[model samples]
Structure formats: C-alpha cells, structure tokens
Target: MSFAEPSRIEPDDNQSRGIALAILLLPLTLPLFLFLCLFVFLPVGLFAFLFSFTGELLFYLSMWNDGRTLTRRRLRRRLAAGETGTLIIEYPMLAQGRTHAWWTPDDISTLAPLPIPDRSSDEYQDAVLDLMEQDQSHPWDAWCWQEYTSTSQGKASLLRVWNGKKYQEWLARHYPSIPIVETTSEIVRQLEIEAQQKSHQPQP
Candidate 1:
C-alpha cells in the first residue's frame, strides 16, 4: 500500500536561535582554551585543546546552515518507503543538539480509552498547536516513534498526533475504502517480507 506523502515543515527562523548560539560559542572556544592553558594545569591544557576542537566541530555539524535540508531529505525518503504513520512525530531538540528518532505508528499504545478533546476550532487558541495533542488513553504523552526501548517491550505505548485528519481526508477523496493504519512499521515489515519472498521466487 502506498503511504501518504510526507511534508517537511521548514523550521522557522526562530528555530535558528540554537544555530545562532552555536555559532557564537564556536569562536569563543579558542580564547577560553588559551586562557585555561595559561592559568591552569598542563593536563587541563591538553584536555581543553582536545575538547575545544571536538566541541566546535559538533556545534558546526549540528547547527550548519544546511542541516535543515538534510533532515528534510531523510524524512522524505522514509515517507516514500511507507515508513511513517499517523503516530510518527519528529522531535528536534536544538538545545541538546540532536534529532531524536522518528516515532512510528506501531509504537503507540493506549493507557486507557479516553476521548481526545478537540483543542482546535476554539476562538481564542493560537494559530497552531506547537506539540501534539493526544487521546487521554495514550500511555505516554511523548514517545520516540519507530524506536523501541527495552522498557517498551511487550507493553504498548500510546500514539497520538493531529490524528491524520488531512491524510485521511485525501485518501477518502481518492480511494474511499483504503485501509490506512495509524502507524507504518507493520506495513514496512510486511513489505520487507514480500520483497524477500519475491527475490527468492524462481525465475520463469
């Protein structure tokens, strides 16, 4: 089955705040290291030199001006391969300087059955909801989709998002009876099986 086309939301300029911070800190490392080397122990000097170079490189890599495009391309490939579902949410942690794993649909589970109240359509609400809203039944409010943790074994976790309203609407308009699951891991797993089977099939 084909998956919904993934759209990469461009991080707003405000999101560049992290990059700005990284850039500002990048230049200060040398002077700080020199000062430390001059006033501190020799071991401190060696460690300072090594850590300063590594830190600057990490900052540049994580906050490069082109990093956003790299992220978007990776996401597009995953989407095209039917690798994401409604429950998948990309977590970008700029403060920590890392992109968390893309959460998959199958990873979501319900803590209990509870209705997700409609937060939209309210008169006084903001133009956008920054984080995802979940059905109260979801076990965890935020889960790393697609990534399975040792603690998550056997136990189901909750998956929630905008509830795939747009994707469902598009599918309904195109193929009214299409069966789209909340997550994509099962589909991808099945696809892998099918591919292996086809590869092993005898040639006519």
Candidate 2:
C-alpha cells in the first residue's frame, strides 16, 4: 500500500539567493558614475565631463558588482554544502490565492526560540548547545508551517524526525486528511513489516 506524502516536502517556487543578489546590484553602477563626474573633477572640456561620468559610474558599478559577487559566493557555498535542517517560515494572514513567502533558511546558522535548559547538568546543556548549533548550521532544513486566523497566532508543527509519526500527527491535525509519507528509516521498516504481514494473509 502506498503511504501518504510528507506535507513539508514540496517544490519551492521562489528565486534562489544568487538571482536575488544579482538583481539587487544591477543598477547601483549608474549612480556611482554620476557622483564621480559631479565631485571628482570640475573641468569644462568634453573629455573631462565624459571621464567624470564614466569614473563615477564605474565606481558605483564596481561596488555593486563586488557586493553581488560576495553574495553569490556565499549563496553558492551554502547550496553546495548540501546543508540540512530547519527553516523559519513566514506567510501572510490571508491570501487571495497563495501566500507570498520568504525565508532566509540557507544562511541561517541558528534558530531562536529553542527550548533552553535552566541550571541543568553541564552535559545536557552541552548536548542542547550542539543541537542548536547544528540547527543554525542549516536553518533551511528545519521548518515550522503555521496558519493563523485573522487575529491569534497559528498552530505550530510538532518536532518530528522527518516523515515520522509526529509529522503525521501534525498533518492530520493541521492539514486534515493529508497523506503522511514515511521516509525515515524506522518508519519505512515498520511499514514494510506491516505490508509483508498483510500480504501473508491466509486465503480470504
């Protein structure tokens, strides 16, 4: 029997960081050129005027380009790392069709609001710290999807090892009737065992 699909594993319809950074810096060069012409040189000749404009433009352009290049490099590093775990999701209160969503999951090295132990054992605290640090290392992987009413905070998803029972419960409660596909090793084995049991049914 086919199990339900995991609710969170859906295709993203958004621009990646590389594209966003490139677009952001594309027009910055123009202003740089204009500034250089105005302040750097006050000459009357055509060549001086042209040079000033070009220099200013190039200056701004260079800054913009540098910023974009840095952004792209960072984005590439994150993407190539196959970094996993955690996303802080934000969506609108109400949408006409679909909500406009944006998240900085890739660069997130730490997610706030995690449960912190108070005066606990050093060992336990250390472990918690490790988990939190790991969570930050790949914020994009961990996710919490919430849907709010016109007012009030929406329900938060339960922390489930991906495709585990907790995730299934979250789907059943929040999404309702949504299929929960178990992709985790433990859950998959449980499923396989159940399947084999059903298959071995004494002739119906």
Q: What lDDT does the true structure give each of the candidates? A: 0.38, 0.35
lDDT of predicted model 1: 0.38
For model 1, residues 48-164, the per-residue Cα lDDT tens digits are: 777856654553354333332124354346556765343222222212222222223341334223332222234212212322232111122222221331112212222212122
RMSD list, candidates in order: 24.4, 31.4
For every model in order, what is the number of clashing pairs? Answer: 8, 14
Q: How well does candidate 1 score on lDDT at residue 16?
A: 94
Q: How close is candidate 1 to the true structure, as a TM-score?
A: 0.22
TM-score of each: 0.22, 0.16
lDDT top scorer: 1
Count backbone clashes in candidate 1.
Answer: 8
Q: What is the lDDT of residue 152 in candidate 1?
A: 21
Q: Which stretches in model 2 have alpha-carbon errors above 4 Å? A: 1-77, 105-110, 114-204
